[model samples]
Target: MKHYLLFAAGKDRPGIVAAISRILYRHGCNMADSTMTRIASEFAMLLIFQAPAGWRAERIGQELQRCEKRLGLFTGIKPLASSESRALKPKGRAHIISVYGADRPGIVYRVSRCLASKRINITHVSTHRTETSRAAGYVMLLEVELPSLRMAAGLNKSLGRLASGMGLHVSMRPVETAKL
Candidate 1:
């Protein structure tokens, strides 16, 4: 089996996923992982899948090109190296950080900088902006891997300082993982 990554983006509409998945299915591709989300007015996807060794990159590209034209999507596919196909094991405990504040610039950059300084690895991030009668509100959720429990106290303190300095609310908690 050979692994490949597919990226697709276009206007948000019904049948986008179905159209793309149909092409993969018809070509005997098995999806290993995928993320699809709508950001503002656009939809985006990242998919990792395995295909039969006989499925050449050129063949896959041609199929995707047809699908793109049919669906009016921008699509790209690339083969994954063996090393890149393997998922990265989390190096530490997982945690979720929540940030809420008035809509303003630099929120993401400032918060990410703090986490970077602590060597925390961010696994996922999602943010939303809401409008209230009084003001625009922003909410950012970050899934991160913490180096150790010992740093939790200090991390919280640091975040508290940032919250106060930036007039934002920040909170974090460990993620509960299910044991199989």
Candidate 2:
């Protein structure tokens, strides 16, 4: 089997997943992993799938292109190399880091820079901005891999200092991998 990645984005609406999955089913593609969500008014999907031998990325791209108008989505497909198709295996224990603060620029930049400096690996991140008549709020959730408990302790201290300086709430907790 050959692995491929697919990305699609369009206005949010009912039947988007059904339509796309139907296409993949007809094409003999078995979805391996996928993420689909709405960001504001737009819906986006990223899927890693496997195709039967002899299937070509160009062929799938053309097929998806024909459906773009009907589906109201901009789609792209890419063939994955053998190494690129492997699943991620982080070299440390998984953790979830939470950040909440007043809406401000540079929050992600500063936080991500700190993580990079610690050599932490961020696997997933999602952030939201909330607005009300009173004020705006920011929330960020990051799934990261910490190298060790010792490193986590140092990181917690650093994050404490960062939170105190920026007037934000930052916390970290181990993810229950067994539950996952």
Per-candidate TM-score against the hidden true structure: 0.90, 0.92
**Which portions of model 1 miss their true places by more than 4 Å?**
178-180
Instruction: After the best TM-score superposition of candidate 2, give how far the Cα of residue 94 lies from its true spot, in angstroms.
Output: 1.0
- Pairs of residues clashing in candidate 1: none
lDDT of 1 by residue, 23-62 (tens): 7898888998899999999999999989997887677677
**Per-residue lDDT value at 30 in model 1:** 93
List the global CA lDDT of all models.
Answer: 0.90, 0.89
Name the weakest run of 10 consecutive residues (lDDT summed) in model 1: 56-65
lDDT of 2 at 175: 90
Give the Cα error of residue 33 in candidate 1, in Å: 1.1
* Candidate 2 segments whose C-alpha is farther than 4 A from its true place: 177-180
With a 3 Å backbone cut-off (N, CA, C), the pairs that clash in candidate 2 are none
Model 1, global lDDT: 0.90
